[model samples]
Target: MSVTGAVDWDQWLRRWDAQQTVYLPDRESRFDAMLDVVQALLPETLVALDLASGPGSLSQRLLRRLPKARCIAVDLDPVLLAMGRAVLGNFGRRLAWVEADLRDRAWAERLGVREVDAVLTTTALHWLEPDDVRALCTTLAQLVRPGGVVLNGDHLAFPLHLPTLQQAARTLKGRRLEERRTAPGAEDWDQWWAAIEAVPALRELCAERKRRFAWREKNDTPPPLELYEQALADAGFREVGVIWQNMDNRVLMAVR
Candidate 1:
């Protein structure tokens, strides 16, 4: 499933990871915490739905950790999906790349499976609005089997009741992110995309990506942790809470 021999998908994926680190300096640590929770809660052969799974970042790690585990890596971006399919598709049957918009209710139906043991996403769900996220939870409630779980690792905002703390945390995180962006050899988001667009192998895929997401608008602010808790509770999850955190960035867990 790889592209022509001209493109080095491995190198592009590495650059993708580097640019992502500019926003989340402790990205690897967060991934570790998330995988630790998955290992503790699920069986080695568990089936996981990796929503917004850009270039199989979490999916690759989970596959390596569990060996027998399977991941359905879902994303709408054609460019990233192409990269993931090229690089991680070697996992053979253990990993699947599904192209679907998470905001669309029918996205889950395309997975071809009735249920999964866990649904996981990281640093990507923020692209969704609060209502869309709630709707996604409702769909996930049906998709995840009873006794299963959902884990979201991202910057979920603090409650408005803690306004001062929220502002302070946001400022600190912004400062830290700026520092990371200025680090030697760092590639910012725009720079990464520019590089991708400059590559002939990905030109058509990039154009397709633009066509797919051109109508979508990103949320200016991330949804609060409380909103996610309430949404999951309403969606029938038995238990929901933050299992790991660094500043406002946290891993929210919901057990079915």
Candidate 2:
């Protein structure tokens, strides 16, 4: 399947930055959980790859946990890469920000990063088609060294109680309620939707690409967690399991 065409990098960056500043309530918790999983899998310093790493949040958290470990954070958006560099520049020698499409196999080779100890991605990767997902899993298995791990933190599968289409809506509503109680006056879900609508670049990109921007809205049918486990197994990963979860969101880890 054809992926979405190039987006307006500048506009996309602005909107993404605004969205993150407004809605990253559990950022710390998410990062902490990822660190916990990586530490459990690998005892000492190891190379970590953060795929689709927008703004380097996961990379930064990893750096904090493993100061000596090197991190290669990759993404397709140039603007996001710049933002990540700015945010993580303090880690002078520990972090490397790369701009490349995660869907491309050549990207892995280009990075000159032959083997990784752990790979992590959060709130990303679901944008790809099923075929792309399968290819990514296969590539990940090959790139990761023996005893290395891959952790994906995103909405793995829609909850059984709700229809796939309604899942986004339910999640957005729940987020709004939580924000009202805890982060009052903060830009709630409605505000985020409005922000996306107002951004001409995102609006045009969404219309042109037929991609879903709303929190609960989705385009394709997501496979079950078991399906992902099987995919990893086929890819040569020995141990696969969910490390953390909340509703439909989850952090799945697999060891090669």
Candidate 3:
């Protein structure tokens, strides 16, 4: 439970695993879709980018699946990055962390690598404003090499006309997650934050995270999938489209 300078990585991974399931019950299925594409399109050994990676969730999962691949996991949250280093230990240098804000236009240069084979992001980019998302994809197009891939999975919503359907879909997923949430030692989002706050050693890091992200408003929702498609296309991607989807949460793929 000590998510500080010295954490029990196994225990932290367990908590993160449970919390991830609470957020996306079908996370593994979606990951499988992502992995399938990566394996099919990418080389046997490659360098990939993990955008806005939190606590090394997708990075670790990617390593577990593709042992030969190296990942550069980038995020601006020092708190999560600290936990990631503790839990993931740089993956013996195969997995590296870069502290850069995705909102910044020149973030790609901070990655140290000029270009990469693929870039993957999940449940993270939606936090950006519409303009920021467009800017990010434009930069992504430049960062990725020709024939490289970019995959982003998040709650890409439909327009206002589907309000009723959206609410119903949300309610169904919530109820389903709630049913299995009572399992022993499970931690929901609020509970996880509570645990982080209750720990004396983690307080300062958490405070810094709050200060960093306090500027964001809750209403900063993801734009429609069409906009994402357009952004990638405008970014000069050779081919861009949705490859996997489940209601609001879908993976958009683009080849640079």
Candidate 4:
């Protein structure tokens, strides 16, 4: 069966929230942990950047906690960004949307902020090639003020050099957790994309996505946690490491 009904901004926004929980069962917990790191490192008033921000989900959540915060939401996904602006427009003039291709090294200039108190991303960096991820982090570090925090929440796998049995056990646990995460209302990734494609209103944005992002990279495996830790250190950040983790997915924080 196809989900062919017209998709409104709120419909897609709700579906995006539902689908993220399907993949990340502890979505709320992860958000809490990520924000905890932010509030700990930053004050109530904030100048923030939301990287690879899909439909302004994290931006909305962040503003809910710190309404005075100004956030610049950056992403290459036009469809998602459009829905984000349409649905989250009421968050006030504090939210600004920037369409950016992170693969380009100069994407930071588009952010329109000299330095931010916090830079945050969730479940979105893994899509980048490893080098791009490193560059993105380095750019974020540059954008953040001294002592400001750079936080990434993604599926950062453990070191592949570990013993075989230990890795196998981790894999097994991830599978079991994923199985448990499936709920009646949950939509899988493929299903969500298909639903997006079926909506008549989204035809143009769907075509834009196909043109801009149809190519998959040769490597899909995210770098290990150590690589991120090292990248942060090399980029002149201090106190970098994982703050909270479940299975392969983790929230890593670093102070610049």
What's the TM-score of every candidate structure? Answer: 0.96, 0.73, 0.91, 0.91
Q: Per-residue CA lDDT of candidate 2, range 181-238, in tens?
A: 3564455435645654555544553353233223224544445666577788888999
RMSD of each: 1.6, 6.8, 2.6, 3.5
Off by over 4 Å in 3: 1-6, 161-168, 180-185, 219-222
lDDT of 2: 0.70
**Candidate 1 total steric clashes:** 0
Q: Among all windows of ten consecutive residues in candidate 2, which has the lowest summed lDDT?
A: 208-217
Clashing pairs in 3: none
Tens-place lDDT per residue, model 1, 1-256, is 2344388889999999988888888889998988998899889899998999999999999999999899999999988998898889859689988989988978888998999999999998888878898999999999999999999999999999999979988899889878888889999988999988988876777888889888777654667889899999999999999988888999999999
Q: List lDDT for all candidates, in order.
A: 0.89, 0.70, 0.83, 0.81
Displacement of the residue 124 alpha carbon in candidate 2, Å: 0.2
Model 4 Cα RMSD, Å? Answer: 3.5
Give me the runs in candidate 4 sitting further than 4 Å from their true place: 1-7, 164-170, 177-182, 218-220
Better by lDDT, candidate 3 or 1: 1
Task: Specify the poorest-scoring 10-residue window by lDDT in model 1.
Answer: 1-10
- The residue-level lDDT of candidate 2 at 22 comes to 53
Candidate 3 local lDDT, residue 14: 71
Clash-forming residue pairs, model 4: none
Better of 1 and 2 by lDDT: 1
| TM-score for candidate 4, residues paired by index | 0.91
